[model samples]
Target: MTTLPAPLVWTFDGPFERCLADIEDTLRRAIVMVGDVSRVAMLIDLSLPALKQRVDAGEALQPAWGRFLERMARYGLPASPRVRHLRGAGPLATLVIAYRN
Candidate 1:
C-alpha cells in the first residue's frame, strides 16, 4: 500500500480574537499561492470550548467561520467543512476544508 504525504497544516495557537487575523491572512496567501491548483485542503483546528459549544448547538458555522468561508467564496472556492472532535487534546474541533478538482 502506498501512503499519501501529509497535507500542509498551519497551526494558530492563541485566543481566537488574537489569532483570527493571522489565520485569515495565512489562508488568503495560501489561496493565492495555490492558484489554479488541482486540489487544496485547508484544515482549521479550533479547540476552544465556546466554539465547540456553538458548533454542537447546530448553530450556523457562520458565527465561527463565516469570514473565512466568505473569502473562499470570493475566490470561487466553495467550502464544505467537516467537523470532528479530537479527544486527545481537550475537546478540539477540527474543520477540514477539502478542495477537489
Candidate 2:
C-alpha cells in the first residue's frame, strides 16, 4: 500500500575507469534508496559516437566488451549485490540490467 520512488538510470558514455566508477556509485545509491523493496531498471549500451571514439582512441570493442562482462562475472551480475541483466539488446553489446531489491 505504498508508492515507490521513480526508477534510477545511469548512462555510461565510455568504458573508462571513471565512467564505470560512476555507474557503480549510482547503482549503489539506488539500491540504498529503495532498500529491500526497490525496483530498478538499467540500460547500458554503446552509442555510435562513443563506440567510434573509443576505437579511434585505440580501444578495441572486444577487449572492452570483455572487460565489462568480466566485471559482471566477478560481481555476480544476476545475483544479489549486483545488477541483473534482463535482455540482450543485440550484437551492439548493450547491457540492460533490471531488478528489484
Candidate 3:
C-alpha cells in the first residue's frame, strides 16, 4: 500500500466542548499550512466507557466532529470511514490530518 504523508497532529484536553473547539481551530490553522485536507485520524485516549459517559452527558462534542467530518466529505473522503480505538500514552485526544496535496 502506498504510504501517506506524516499527519499534522493536534492534541486536545479540557472540557469536551472546549476540546472540540480546539480541534476545529487547529483544523482551520492546518489548512493554511497543509492546503486542502483529505483524511484525518482521530485518536481518543479515553476508553469506551469514558467516551460513552461524555456522549451521554452531552459532552462528546459531536458538533465539532460533525463539522470536521462534513469538511472531509466535501473533500471526497468517504462520509463513513473505518474507525478504530487505540490505547496510547498521548493526549486525551489527537487529530491527525492528511492534506490532499
Candidate 3 lDDT over 1-101, as tens digits, reads 45446766666655666765576677567655654444443333433454555677777556767775675455443234334455544445667665544
TM-score of model 1 (CA atoms): 0.51
Residue 24 lDDT, candidate 1, scale 0-100: 62
Ranking by TM-score: 3, 1, 2
User: Per-prediction RMSD in angstroms?
Assistant: 6.5, 6.2, 5.7
Stretches > 4 Å off in candidate 1:
1-6, 48-65, 90-101
Clashing residue pairs in all predictions, respectively, total 0, 0, 0
Residues 1-101 of candidate 1: C-alpha lDDT, one tens digit per residue = 43323454565544444355566666566655555433665666666565555457665554446675555556444444334444354423333434443
Best by TM-score: 3
Q: Give the poorly placed runs of model 2, Cα more than 4 Å off.
A: 1-5, 62-64, 73-101
* TM-score, one value per model: 0.51, 0.51, 0.53
lDDT of 2 by residue, 1-101 (tens): 45454544446554554455566566556555655423545556545655566578876656545565566445333443333332433222243445563
Q: Estimate the lDDT of model 1.
A: 0.51
Error of 2 at 73 (Å): 4.3
For candidate 1, what's the RMSD?
6.5
